[model samples]
Target: MSTARWVLHLPAAATSAEGVDRLAQALRDSLRHVPALDFGELTISAEDDQSTRRRVWCDAPLGGDRRCALRTNHPDRCLDR
Candidate 1:
């Protein structure tokens, strides 16, 4: 008998949208034990999409703020009509 956990579900069609950002912020804040305890269980999951478009991937810096990297996937094959 183990305790149940909550998760967060995210839309797969997100492309640097505001909703995604709000969710991310809420998630980060939710990680705090005190704050998280205030809310009920939540699910955090990403949608399943076969078609992954070109998006800048950023790392959540421990010191705060996110930065985009130069390296990318399908960089040459992307950016065209």
Candidate 2:
């Protein structure tokens, strides 16, 4: 791994189907547990990409797109982790 920062290997389609507004809410909800210092630019995909799922990274998102719902929307994954 290139020592750049985090490595959040999300499923890519963490929160799909849900509207963008709901997704953004979800992302915010997830970030509550994380510290702001670990924050980094947020990124998302219209759908799950095989390549991205393999290389997970976690950079705190200040905020994200209001267009697509988060790709990786797992309820258990959020609160549990």
Candidate 3:
């Protein structure tokens, strides 16, 4: 069976990429209690250019159906959430 996913567009007042990332992290942290929310697959992109996306989490496989929990482009070893 295939799982369907949806994109949620949230307009933010952040003026830079770092600011937007910070906002995304905050949102994920605040909503972490929601089981349906996938915190490890968070991302952000320019409001006008949806074609270009940036990953917020590593989302790498860690064996036995587990995934990495570190931020994207991290320099250290992968970790589970």
TM-score of each candidate structure, all chains considered together: 0.26, 0.32, 0.77
Question: Given candidate 3, what's the lDDT at residue 2?
Answer: 90
Model-by-model lDDT, in order?
Answer: 0.38, 0.41, 0.83
Q: lDDT tens string, model 3, 1-81? A: 999988766657688988988888888778979987887877678878978887989999999968987899899999987
Best-matching candidate per TM-score: 3
Of models 1 and 2, which has the larger TM-score?
2
User: Which regions of candidate 1 deviate over 4 angstroms?
Assistant: 1-16, 32-57, 60-81
Please give the TM-score that candidate 1 achieves against the real structure.
0.26
* lDDT value for model 1: 0.38
Among all windows of ten consecutive residues in candidate 3, which has the lowest summed lDDT? 5-14
lDDT of 3 at 76: 100
* lDDT sort, best first: 3, 2, 1
In candidate 3, which residue ranges exceed 4 Å CA deviation?
Answer: 1-7
- Give the lowest summed-lDDT range of ten residues in model 1: 36-45
Residues 51-79, candidate 1, lDDT per residue (tens digit)?
54333232223243323222233343222
